[model samples]
Structures are given as structure tokens and as C-alpha cells.
Target: MGLADALAEWTDVDGAQYELGRATGLFADRTFLQVKWVLWSSNPLGQALYDMLHALVRAGVLEYRDEPDHQFRWRTAAPIDGLDG
Candidate 1:
């Protein structure tokens, strides 16, 4: 599934935060670079989603924290603002 779909599934659970590894693991069949390329591509939908994620961070609806290993850990600070699923 795409990042949006994976995130939707994660939010359905009772847990309030998700580790970056867990999120990445959802797409284990694909290479990380492949996922990165898709998200960074010129596709309008991808761009929109990327923008929305950053907006969430600015809005305090989401937090992207950096770990000591230089990896990121993401979690919702509030209910996701515009996700429909």
C-alpha cells in the first residue's frame, strides 16, 4: 500500500504513535529508494500528499522527531486533519 493507505491503517489501531521502522515495514516488499522516488516524483497526487504531511507538522497535528541514529519517528499529535480514511 501507499504511505497514505498505510498510515490510515495504523491510525485505526489504539496506539497513538508509530515508529518509523513499523511504517517502513508495511512496504517491506519494496525498496526504500523506490518508496522515496514515488513520494518525491512529479505526480500531482504524490506532491499533494507530501505537502499535506508537511502541513500537518506545521499545524502540530503531527510530529517528526529525529532519533540518535539519524532516523525519523513519526506520530500524530492530534487526530489527523484531512485524511478521509
Candidate 2:
């Protein structure tokens, strides 16, 4: 689904998306690099975006965006680093 559609379906507090995204290490915890990479991808079907986005969708915690830097962050209730899939 598109980011706009994802945002429309989100019914939680606005801050949670950031925590989830940051937790994924999908961006190296840096904002601009994340955007630059996603927007400038050259891989087939853009696997970088696809793989990372798939995790977020399965986690069911984030609203994707072309400009994710502007979105809020939400911390998961608990963090289990070693067990993360």
C-alpha cells in the first residue's frame, strides 16, 4: 500500500512511528541519508526500500512516507534486541 493510504489507516498516537523506524536500524539513525537512499534507489524493485518497509508493515507500527523525517517517533512498550527478527 501507498504511504498516504498507510497514514490514513493509522489510528494510533503520532509519535510511535519514529521509535519503530529507528528501532529497525533502517536509517543508520540519520534522517537525510534515509531519504536520500530511498529516493535514489537503483536496485530491482528497490529491495532496500522493500525489505525495510516489509518489516515495518509486518510490525504494524509505522506509516511510510516519501519524507519520513517529518514523521513522529514512537517507542515500543518493550525492546528485546537479541530476539528481534
Candidate 3:
């Protein structure tokens, strides 16, 4: 599934923050991560996922934050309709 679709599944539950690496790992295989780590380029789907998330941030649909340790977190900007209540 696309990043948006996977994110929707998670956001449907709540607007809690999620780490980018952990989230990406859930959708990608270990080999993909290892190769990308060594090659310095990620898989196409990883790029697409980041692109989608950037779009969401631009649209104010999601909020992106960096923790002190440098990990990124994302959460819905507001309570999702129907799901929040």
C-alpha cells in the first residue's frame, strides 16, 4: 500500500505521534533498508512515502516534529472527523 493508505490506517485509531523510521520499516523489508543504508539512496516507495508526508505537512493535515535524538514524528494536526469522537 501507498504511504497515505498505511498512514490512514494508523491515524484512524488516533492522532498519536509516530516515528518515520519505524513506520517506514513496517512497510519495507530489511534487505531494502540495508541496501539503502549502504547505497545512500532509498527505495522508490520510501521516497514516495516521504513525498506524501511532506504534502500532508504542507496541507496542514499532519504535523511533523523532530525529537532531541533527531528522529522524526508525525501526527494529525487535528482530530480526524468521525474517528475522534
Best by lDDT: 3
The sequence of per-residue lDDT tens digits that candidate 3 reaches over residues 14-68 is: 1122223335564245443454432244566456555656665675565555443
Each candidate's clash count: 0, 5, 0
Instruction: Show the colliding residue pairs in model 2.
Output: 15-73, 15-74, 16-74, 18-73, 19-74
Q: For residues 1-85, could you state the per-residue lDDT of candidate 2 as single tens digits?
A: 2233334433232223322344455444466444454434565424544455546545653444445443422223323454322
lDDT of each: 0.42, 0.40, 0.42
Give the per-residue Cα lDDT of candidate 1 at 26: 38
Hey, what RMSD does candidate 3 come out at?
7.9
Identify the superior model by TM-score, candidate 2 or candidate 3: 3
Give the per-residue lDDT digits (tens) of candidate 1, residues 1-85: 3343345423311121122223445334555454564454576645554455556557654554434322222343435566433
TM-score of each: 0.36, 0.28, 0.37
Identify the superior model by lDDT, candidate 1 or candidate 3: 3
Q: Global CA lDDT of candidate 3, please?
A: 0.42
Q: Looking at candidate 2, what is the lDDT of residue 44?
A: 41
